[model samples]
Target: MGNLLGSWRFKEPSTVEECDSTWGSDSEDDEPAVEDDSGVSDSVSPERERAAGDSSPQLAEPRDSLPKMKRSFYAARDLYKYRHSYPNYRKSRQPNEYRNLCFYLNKIPLVPDGIYIEEILTKWRGDYDKLEHNHTYIQWLFPLREQGLNFYAHELTQDEIKEFQSTREAKRRFLAAYSIMLDFYGIKLLDKSGNVARASNWQERFQHLNESQHNYLRITRILKSLGELGYEAFKAPLVRLFLEESLCHNTLPNMQHSVLEYFVYTIRLPATRRQLLRYARQHYRPAHAFLWGPPPKRRGGGGAEGSVGAGSSGIRAPAPTPEPQRRAEESSPTASSGIIVSSHDAMMCQELGGEGLKSSAGLGSSMSRLEGALMMAGARGEMNDYSEIVPL
Candidate 1:
């Protein structure tokens, strides 16, 4: 009985000095010891053990902090590269307020005397036949009636005037209907007359434009008006419009001609062919490379300049093909073959290198191991090796 009592004796509790030396004075009073019926002692208290876990230094910092630090480091490195590589890069980095000022300045239309007169002439050329033969055309004309009379008269002949009136009236009706359709889609177009308008249910009208003329006039109007907000602001509205219409599903046949004509006729801006290219890249898909897929050759004696009559007439002739071809040939070594290799070429080159080959080999091995594991786990039946798969 004495031997059994000795085995069951409770060990004396350690002194406060011992507890302080082990876990510091702050935890000395907080920690409490425990003993079983047999009186075996445990060095750590329950509270001390929990405190040890809660105060781990490893878990002190947040999980997201490291990733944020890495991202900022990369961004700084990219900005340094951009600043050193490009000469005009700093212009783009101007304060947002300064950029807005430049943007607003460009939006002010250059309404010169000549341009104003041209607008009047354009209006007259279309409306003249609609007026009674003796209906005082001069009185109906806007403020600019006296300048460049011969050109205006020559251009607006009796037959031309009739055609123009027919076209103009048709366009007006179409615009009215189109405005209603835009309203259904929650988009409104402000007319030149200061009236906010919407499009009618113009599914048929849209189909006509798509199949017959390939001219989306309402869309063009939206793009042109929004374009006055400058390039960046213009893109978002255009993209949003396209997404709302689900235009991406259908490939636009004659996209270049349709887009350019929309800009020229509806926008009524003298956009050069180069400007058209820029517009396509900025507004359309970044991957869109084809421009009418082989532009037609300009034929005649004096090339583009002579054909267009380049002396302030404001009419630009179509670009001559030979000159474009010559320029293309000079720019590319394989231009004649119509081969264009962009960044995709660089990736292919890297894949053929030693380091890339080694990495690819490792990937192949890991993939094989994964396949084996999947097969063993009954997730797959069999596997075939794809070690020879090319990068590009």
Candidate 2:
């Protein structure tokens, strides 16, 4: 312990004269010969050490950088990838809200413009000879038509139909009013020869009707009236419109309702019903409860085995009959159209539902499926070729 303490003694600085004398006293040969290896230790500077210390850690190498499949298998495992919300076919509505034309017209005052229809007709009786000559009446007719006074508006000439500028809301209201009037009166437009006005190309004049947002409702209403009257001449055009996603899928909930209502009306005809049902099948949704009935009441006895068997078939049975046709008078507006939408359909409708056949690609694919379905159902005659036509 004493020897170790002696070895730890501190040294004192040499005098200036002694340090000066010893500074260069020893030659290079006299200094202990230093050995040099590669001098690699000198290469690492303080700056490099600081930089290495500050750098972030690197990620580990991927286990399978280039898998055989180009597609991502992990994507399939994500449950959300395939999950989607269903569309609402019959969204909830107030009890008083009317869906039928007849009841609505019957319930509302006939004097939609705050004046009697007979009085207006009497005032304009002088202009009866030359309908266009009564510019004031024509002007009055258009505003009232815009106001949804369809009963009175229907009395106007075809020239009036042209004169009435088309708008989305205006067209919808007019059609709703006009359709009810037609249903009530059973009035038919006739040519000079007393023949039903049957122009093969009347639909052609309004070809661009549904092309824009402004006129879509107008076209939809016209199509509905044509269908209600059983105007089979417009059947092909209606089918073509069905194929158009833009026309079928609209932002306006009422517009969508009109289209669906029109579909219900059109399907009363056996020929169009088959095609529409076929379309509904491929795009089967709980919202389509109106058309396809409640999802086949599940059978508890079948369980998984039964479901597997049903799925194995991959084809559903024919749908049930839709509700009755619209009642023109006495029925509440909601129940006006004899069509009875079940509670199940209403329940299925989402808060933001009513988007039907909204995508062209989806529509085309579904239509193809429908065509095949119709062919199998022996509806070849009803299958009108709609390939070349673009309704817009």
Which digits, one per residue and each the tens of the lDDT, describe model 2 over residues 174-260?
444333322222222332221232133334322322332323323433443343332434443344344333233431222332343
Task: Put down candidate 1 lDDT per residue, 1-392, tens digits, no spaces.
Answer: 99985456423223212211221222222223531112111234554423322223432343222111001122122222211221122122223323112212232211222222223323433232222122222211211111121222111122322332345443343244334334433345564432332245345333443453312423443343333222212333333333323324343333333353223222212122223333333333212112211121234422232211101111122332455665766588777578544334433432221011222222212333211121111102221122111100
Pairs of colliding residues, candidate 2: 88-349, 98-333, 98-334, 99-333, 99-334, 102-328, 324-338, 325-338, 326-337, 326-338
Q: In candidate 1, which residue pairs get closer than 3 Å at backbone N, Cα or C atoms, i.e. clash? A: 178-199, 179-198, 179-199, 180-198, 180-199, 180-200, 181-199, 181-200, 182-199
Compute the lDDT for candidate 1: 0.28
- lDDT at 37, model 2: 26
TM-score against native, each model: 0.21, 0.23
Residue 42, model 1: lDDT of: 22
